[model samples]
Target: MGRTASVLLRVLGMLWTAPNTGLGLIAGSVGLPFGARVHFDPHTVALVFHRWPWGPGGAMTLGNTILHTGETLDAPCLTYAHRAGHCEEPPVRIGDHERAHVYQYMALGPLFLPLYLVCGGISVRNRFERAADRYAQTGRGWWPW
Candidate 1:
């Protein structure tokens, strides 16, 4: 998409997921000056609350991890980098999945939140999640497997 459309979609995504995104922003702001680090990229923004050594022990203290929020694919994301685990995929991969979620937020608008909550338990097969996974893996194609 063109720059304008992309920007519009991102704004819409933020509005669509306002509650969570707003909270994320607040949390990020509170944490930023307190040893937290925020990283920005073309497709994602990540907020790292702590840079503990990567290992099992570090993961324990970094409980309660939160992922991305907002309508834009490159929205602010909260995560514990140390707990990303054995996937070995770059952290951006998680952001790619979240970008797909931004698209979902754009498509569903306000309805997305309630629907997401209702489907949270079965997210593995949820249409929204499946679409997001597809977008992350392939960048475009979608299938509801």
Candidate 2:
């Protein structure tokens, strides 16, 4: 895909996930300021630093933190601290996966949430999650699933 289209998808992702994005921004500004450093990539998605020690601990939480609302948050931003004493994978790989989720947001818009819930299962069975995994492995500029 062209850069313009990629950017447009990201913008649409932001708008589609606005409610969660707003909560993430608010959380970052309020409680997360000292807890984590926020990083916004060229894709315009926000990544928050979340040390595993301070909050909940899990491998799933290591990348895009899935909230109670069932939203896998990669848009807007949230800190993702590596587990203490464990070396997480390089940011490039993680970013690729997360970026794919951002694209999913763009494609599904408001429908993403409910659909994600209905399709809830292991990543392998979930079409959205599978597409994201594919994107991470393949790189950018492909059609959104």
Clashes of each: 2, 9
TM-score of each: 0.52, 0.57
The lDDT of each candidate is: 0.46, 0.47
Candidate 1 wrongly placed segments (more than 4 Å): 1-3, 30-35, 45-92, 141-145
Best by lDDT: 2
Q: Cα miss at 36, model 1 (Å)?
A: 3.1
Give the poorly placed runs of model 2, Cα more than 4 Å off: 1-9, 27-34, 50-92, 140-145
Q: 16-55, model 2: which lDDT tens digit per residue?
A: 7776555455554453445444544454255544432233
Best by TM-score: 2
RMSD (Å) per prediction:
8.4, 8.2
- Sum up the clashes in candidate 1: 2
Give residue 56's lDDT in candidate 2 (0 to 100).
Answer: 40
Q: Tell me how far the alpha carbon of residue 115 in candidate 2 is from the true structure, in angstroms, after superposition.
A: 0.8
